[model samples]
Target: MKLSLKVNGKKIEKEVDDNTLLVSFIRENLNLTGTHVGCDTSQCGSCVVHVNGKSVKSCAMFAVDANGSEVTTIEGLEKDGKLHPVQESFKKHHGLQCGYCTPGMVMSSIDLLKSHKNPTEEEIRKGLEGNICRCTGYQNIVASVKGAIGKV
Candidate 1:
């Protein structure tokens, strides 16, 4: 299959298997390893990425399905050598521990903030329900989201 898409603001065209998972294509074909594949079953949000400005679990979708779409991995969140505001907030608030889930958490949090400009703790919790963080217990994650309320 010929896969062509804009990844991290760069146009990309490559030949990949028709059944290649989006995560695999991103990490293997594109060498964007920031989108981790924690679980192939899609239960883990570690493979989350923004497809055409919406967060989607890359493991659940095929690369061919993403053809012609704009994909943003965790690597794309940084611009001009600076981290995204949500990423900066996460770092400032100590929202990560093992770091395995930070990419997904950050991506999902960005989407959450887009929908809820000023989300309450409960709303943030609900928004991040799809993403599981085993280390933080969500106290700091919520704080990070709160910290990035208006910065997104």
Candidate 2:
């Protein structure tokens, strides 16, 4: 299949198998390894990426399905060599420990904040339901999201 899309603000056109998962295409074909594939079952949000401005699990979708769409991986969040506000907030609040789930958590949190401008603690918790973080006990993660409430 011929896959064409804009990834991380760059035009990409490649020949990939029809069964190629979006995560695989991003990591292997595009060499954007930031979007991790924790679980192929899609239970883990580690493969989350923004497709046309909305967060979607790259592992669950096919690269061909993403053709012509604008895909933003964790690598795309930065601009001018500076971290995104959410990424900065995560660092300031110590939202990550193992760093395995930070990319997905940050991406999901961005979408959450986009929908709920000022989410409460419970709302923040609910918003992060799918993205699992084995470390940090979620206290600092929630704080990070709160810290990015208006900044995002």
Q: What tens digits encode model 1's per-residue C-alpha lDDT throughout 1-152? A: 99889999999999999999999999998889999988778887989999999999999999999999999999999889999999999999999999999999999999999999989889999999888888989899899999999999
Candidate 1 overall lDDT versus native: 0.93
Count backbone overlaps in model 2: 0
Where model 2 places Cα greater than 4 Å from the true spot, the runs are: none
lDDT of 2 at 18: 97
lDDT of each: 0.93, 0.93
10-117 per-residue lDDT for model 2 (tens digits): 998999999999999999988899889897788879899999999999999999999999999999999999999999999999999999999999999999999999
Pairs of residues clashing in candidate 2: none
How many angstroms is residue 80 displaced in model 1 relative to the true structure, after the best TM-score fit? Answer: 0.8
